[model samples]
Target: MEKFVRVKGVAAPLPLANVDTDMIIPARYMKALTRTGLGRHLFQELRFDDADRERASFVLNRPACRDARILVADRNFGCGSSREHAVWALTDFGIRCVIAPSFGDIFSGNARKNGLLLIRLSETLCDHLRREIALAQHAAIEVDLAAQRIRLASGETIAFDVDTDDRHILMEGLDDITRTLRHADAIARFEAAIESLMTIP
Candidate 1:
């Protein structure tokens, strides 16, 4: 997983609440075995129409937000299902972070494991951010994980909070395997002791 130290890019405004996993990436697109290539199908239903044409009304399809790396969303984002694919789709689509009032329990876990930063803020603060981003000349903002703050293009700053463990995981880019490997020496010592005891018999 890539380390998420800081991200600066257009912050897309997704004001809708209760965006589910199926909406992020429909199950039809989950047939593939690998995580790659799912980016194209991210927000499949909302981004494309019944005929598979791009929806002009979708925020992601708009020119300013087409390459957005950060998303400012409403409450209860990622509310349905426990699919990790939703997190995959977002990361694959180049979204490194999502700012919402709250997230689904399962979806939050998937996001952390997958290296996507989810920031929880008050509804009023998120609304303020969305408004600022929309009015900015380029709709770009910067999020610094080290400092736990957001800097808008207008030179204003806002503080945010993240769990210490979550921050460490992202900053160190430590996946589960990598994290486990950090205890390699201890694990090896324990195994060696067990082997010695078995040989004593």
Candidate 2:
């Protein structure tokens, strides 16, 4: 997992609501059995045509939105099935942060574990930021995890909310395995104590 203390880069606008996990990385692409290569299939249905051509009209396909590291999306952005691959695809595609009004509970947990920062703000604010990024030539924004605010190219800042534990996990780049390993000494001691008690009995 990558530490996400701060990210400053191009911001892409996804205006559609209820952008589900399947939409993020369709089920057809899940056969790879590895987290790698999923980015190419992200939004496969919407990003490609019948002949497997890139759709020019999609927001992510636009020239300015290419290589965007921050995504400002509409409400209920990560809704639907609980595929952790969605977060993997986003991170593999270089998306360090996502801003939306809400997210699916499972998706939120997956994202936090994978080191992708998800910011929750009001729908109105998300829409405003999405529109601004869409219209701007640079479409660049800054997300500071320590400050819990997003800074637009125009110098305007908007506050967002994230769970304190999630924020700590992301900032410290603590994946599930790493988090567990941090308590290795304590776990070893507990196991030894249990073994001694069993032997005495």
What TM-score does each of the candidates earn?
A: 0.97, 0.96
Distance (Å) between predicted and true CA of 108, model 1? Answer: 1.1
Off by over 4 Å in 2: none
Q: lDDT tens digits, residues 12-50, model 1?
A: 999999998898889888988889999999999899999
Winning model by TM-score? 1
Q: Report the Cα lDDT for candidate 2.
A: 0.88
**How much lDDT does each candidate structure score?**
0.93, 0.88
- Regions of model 1 farther than 4 Å from truth: none
Candidate 2 structure quality by residue, lDDT tens digits, 1-201: 889999999998887899999999988888888888888988889999989999999978998877989888888888999999999999888899888888888999899899999888888898888777766775678999999988998889988777889988999999999999999999999999999999994
**lDDT score of residue 70 within candidate 2:** 88
